[model samples]
Target: MPAAHHPDLELDDIQAGALAERPSPYVGKYLLLRITDRADGRELVRRLHRIATASRTSERTDDTTLTVAFSYHGLEALGVPQTSLDSFAPEFREGMAARAAVLGDVGESSPEHWEAPLGSTDVHVAIAALSPDAARLEAAAEQARRAHAELPGLEVVWRQDCYQLVTGRTSFGFRDGIGQPAVEGSGRPSTNPREPSLKAGEIILGYPDETGELPPMPMPEVLGRNGTYVVFRKLHTKVAAYRNYLRDRASNREDEELLGAKMVGRWQSGAPLVLAPDRDDPELGADPQRNNDFLYAEDARGFKCPVGAHARRANPRDSLYQDGSVDVRLHRMIRRGTSYGPMLPPGELEDDGEDRGIIFVFAGAHLKRQFEFVKTQWLNDGIFIGAPEERDPLVGPNDESSGFTIPQRPIRRKLQNLPPFVVTRGGEYLFAPGLNAMRWLSELDT
Candidate 1:
């Protein structure tokens, strides 16, 4: 069935950066700021309100862009009324740091080991600048810098430079930014024909969600309408270790590539294993129309794309429909990822101390049901699929006891003793308010 269309959405008041699809081969940066002085902070927001573009404009242009969001503490620092603060979702108020254990951020991925100021209360506001090239990226960054140039109360606490690898792959050597859910009435087409555009409330507040009910929003109708929750995470990828593990398991070069594809459920070219089960089809991968148009209903047995693969776990599609009780749309989110740090020298199996990984950003209305549910239920546990001990093979926080199973002919092949391939550097939960909401913040008397 086609998604219910919402024609009356307030696109003009929504931040373009929140719904705009990033350009290919882009350059970007994340700036974490602390508001030491409330008055100056309001002034910063006022300037930013003028600089941030609306989604209506952002969708049409391929130029540099700026996005602004505030953490829970940020709103409190800026003097948002107590009742208004309490109106927000509890998950957002407690923040990502407090929910670390629920997110499987244990062992090396725990909050104690996270980079300073990321999970800390000091991170007030987040500014992201993205552009198609270096010059444009700098142009966007300059615009952001000018927003608070004279504000002594606001300080840039942390910054991470990010870009798309020339090959358009992450540190893990596989294509990223695939399968983003399209928001209803956003003037954007769904990448997957099998997946309908999500109801507006699934991502933006104040609209009826899949259940035909309005998702909870922050207090004050103007403050929450058209606003969305944001999830920012820094994941450090262990490239060499991933390569070494596959190398030791596979029989030959081709087998090594297949093994990696099986783990991710997609070839490095972005071709899904379910569609190109035996070999990769680069042309198919390059074509967005065909690449994501597949569903897992045909591969129920996991002979093609393993049920435990990272991509499959991230999005089960129709694979879980047999239960009839679950609606996949409720757990969907808008996921965007950009690579940071230089790509590890290709074909090198030895560990290099350089830090390289992906800066993952998620936009959704229901943080717990959409983002957190997927992380804890789908990616970290396998009970839904009948395998209780498994997690996502490629990115799961697996220890020596972790394993992945690939179902095949005579006997199923299982890879044992999987090590953790990705680690959480840090993260935060923020609220990206509508443009008018931002204006409200700037003019706040409280």
Candidate 2:
């Protein structure tokens, strides 16, 4: 195998949110907007164009970034040509809500049960601002406010403020934002030495993906090049319930932590089971060079990292490649998550009734293949791993009937009567256009 030839990416025009690794200890905000007038929407785009940070830049002393995206209805509301609108990926055109069933959003997770303005047609625009501190975050927010503040035609319908928990982990107590793939031309290096750089087209449009072909882009090169689909999902975690479940299943305190690590495939300290199979290694977990460096080839039976564990099912790296029927690389997508609400007090077993979880952000070119495929085939179901009755132990919409199996020495250990630990509050699929596309949209003739 040869090293991939990196493309001359248009970093200056690409949104920083698409490629830039989020800074740790960060504060951010997510805003959902409804576009009432086409002219005002276009004006909003024009204003945001000036503030949306580019992927490659040296002007900022403070690490603050602004990103703007439009939903399918948003493009139409902004008066985008019908032909162009029809040319986008069908999954993006139909919107995430329309495909809820495929994403396992049944029962309480269904769109009808979703939060207001999230899955509705009223959600036209989605803007996100992220920074390392409160002051920088506020500065970015003000810029976004100015973009649509005076525009009576554009109304801010919903806002959710998110930040890194003091423990620098998700509400469930695992270090996250790890295992992000390196985009070939993005200049960011992969944390895992075993992982190869993904083709730029896998994330941004108009570039060759893993298939060695340019993915289908929306009509008109200017509107599609350097752009990508963004998937935003709000998940609510039942921290107290999760803690209680582990406590009930384990023999003692050490076994309780081990059970959690088995489910997540990584200890709370971020140490992977593949590397530190017997114990949690905080030192190894903190070292970026070693934490994400292992593959699942030797653990084909998943004794080290359970096949149905949340992290393993989410990536699976080389585990599925042996069968030749599946290629994990095709489904790979960049995932970024930020915790919202306050963390529950440690070791508390009772429900606090406070809202807290993670806001998941995904960036990729192929929505159906990348994001949706993983959600449907990998996490929600376990057929690919030969465990049809199982789902991801942590985030999957598990029920009393759902069970998780851990490969062990004498025999397999099955944990049954699993309860749903996470619920989908809301979600949206938006198109993040490049700077040139932003300009093209701003100059569109309604």
Candidate 3:
């Protein structure tokens, strides 16, 4: 039997899964799995369906919890009909390895060069866990272990622990997880009031998107409804290298910090350069609503927030409003990242041989328009803003030819031969299905 598709979807029926999930002031862990037993895989899906109530509740979940997502292959492994898998987005179907170069996953970032556990094709499931305390985290881990035990075919291959920093900043000491889009009807409050609110379909599948079109859904309607695509990239940040570059290019410690801010277009406190161009404003960064309120309308000339800055490129809010060449709303994504390694102490310019970086996760209804388009067109290219050969100062390719240019009054200053400070250790494109969809997968004919 084939699953029937529906053209429209309701909001209340959607799962409170990862797309709109908010950050919690606690520690987190991610368990990546690979399926080995075909029959047992569906049994695992059944087990997950049994706890569907406990799952997909909220991102700011209470202590001892986990959220689940599966790759296109994961569903196929569990005997999902080929038709259901075929209806998913192309990128989701092809997987991340095939699109690595377009995503700037070349060189050290390539999956072929990743650690054994990450590069393998056996990767299937992703479980995200969060807790208020370590004891609680361990208890949750035990619970997760017991749950996995329900499916003998499920194998946990890779595990990474992500913790919330006290300063609410990434390993680079800059505030992240800000400037995310607010999906309409997702129940999550908007962070930036002035930034446009995207349609529910833009972030959640089955709803009408910004273009007034509902994205394509998998068969049976139930499996595809309330689902969204996710791109999970584990980025290893070279903290000392980044700090050294800033230090060397700057005249003093203050200048170094300011230079870093210029690279990211935000102060360590989360203040946007367009608002506080000359200094760090902790007060502005503290306000969730006000911090992201400013836009690139008045700063289009690259004087305030350098058109090539990482943050500006990632989300060129008002800058493209007049251009009409690209629709920013259609490309908006829900970005959530957590640092995985130990935090390098402030003012420490030396490397401690510790593995520390961010686990970057982006969720959206349209993977190509939102995540892929942003990565290739915005983050990797400078032509949209005026600089043709320039790359993002913070995380761009930074190859020998890649450099960053800052527009100034006297004369433009260009930093040449910038080295990449971030490496894509591992990543994948996943389908985060609704709770009912989980049930559909469990009930599918085996």
Candidate 4:
């Protein structure tokens, strides 16, 4: 046991420390935020120029935290250096000092615990684009590779393209980038709030002591921080496989729109099929006030949208409310990913060849409580919440070998008869450091 900084104080110190760390050339796009000490609804935005200049060829993407999570990648061509553990020694000390100052603590804090080398599975780099042109994808892929290589000690864990031969969109299809959570007061809540208030220690470290404090470490020592768990996974979708599966089993009266509703659990318009069962409701999907307003209780047993559908499993809504109180707040994930590779070639589409998928990014306070638990217990496991079924038909993994399976059923078919359809390819876990953490690295003593 050691002296640790208060959680509130740690937040600001973490940001300042990361800013001190030089921006890596491999970093393409990033979103950084400093939480307000109070709820005045104000945010501290770090000036990009103050840290590092963007490469001339760099394409920057950022937004308010709630609209979309932060995402970063350097094109393999960027020639960024890989940062090593030795490169981050000195900055670790400064970060601890910054943390102590923010918390108003008086003592020599140690940084050894936070300065250790990140695990191999904790980082990932992926590439995706519009069409199937190897030249185009290769350029992006190379940029990511070079960026990782330049960072002396940071490891690049996994990489893959979306599965497109079967569908027109990325592996998961249904025009992803939907269902993202919106930060409080940013506007209307686009996505539910995952946690009521920010819990700094829980996010950066595995778990804090009962007193809600993190152990103190020398500004440059890497102790107490043994392992940082990261989950990396590449999901490949058979878009064509999904479409054909739907069309073949669709009743003459059920059009393609209806078929998509059943498969995706929502229409392309973002409307949940469970509410607009018989038709595609563009109005509902577009209405900020009405879009996320339905409960699975409408169909109780998942008659409107199958319990095995991706949307249903990803967010159970009222289904999980034991006392008729819908609390979907905990299951939310901040997805900070991008599309990789190119769209399928026109000829390849006809031949049922591979296309592309997405580099799915899910980060939360606790890996086991948030992302891992959701995937293993709910998404991948068939019998979630005590149901007789296996798992979400679209994203559920059948076994380690076969990947995923999409269950099929007649338009009016009972829940028991559906066959499996979707599949998984490859993936890994990664740690998205806050701006403060980045700065702390740049100033570390070699």
Q: Best candidate, lDDT-wise?
A: 1
- Candidate 1, position 423, lDDT: 97
Error of 1 at 356 (Å): 0.4
User: What TM-score would candidate 1 get against the native?
Assistant: 0.97
lDDT of 3: 0.79
Off by over 4 Å in 1: 1-7, 53-60
Q: Where does candidate 1 have its weakest 10-residue lDDT segment?
A: 1-10
User: Per-residue lDDT for 1-446 in model 3, tens only?
Assistant: 12222434454345444554544566888998888887777677767655545544445355455667898778878788887778888888888988888888898788788765664567788887777668777876776677679677888899999887766888999888888777766556677777656887887776778897668777668787787788888889999998888888899988887788878999999999988999899999888878988878898788878888899999998789895778788888888888898999988989999989989888888889889988888888888987878888787876767888788899977777789999888888998788788777777776
lDDT of 2 by residue, 1-446 (tens): 21122366788878888898777889999999999988999999998887774323657756678888999999999989999999999989898899998899988889999999888899999999999999989988988998898899999999999998545698899999778899998888889989999989899988889999789998788899889999999999999999999999999999999999999999999999999999999998878888999999999998899988999999999988886988899999999989999899888899988999999999999999999999989999989989888998888989879999999999988999899999999999999998889988989996
Candidate 4 lDDT score at position 108:
18
Per-model TM-score versus the true fold: 0.97, 0.97, 0.94, 0.56
Those runs of model 2 whose alpha carbons end farther than 4 Å from true positions after fitting are 1-6, 53-58
Report every candidate's CA lDDT. Answer: 0.91, 0.89, 0.79, 0.40
Task: Give model 3's TM-score versus the native structure.
Answer: 0.94
**Model 3 off-target regions past 4 Å?**
1-13, 55-65
Give the range where candidate 2 is weakest over 10 consecutive residues by summed lDDT. Answer: 1-10
User: What CA root-mean-square deviation does each model show from the true structure?
Assistant: 2.5, 2.5, 2.8, 13.5
Backbone clashes in model 1, listed as residue pairs: none
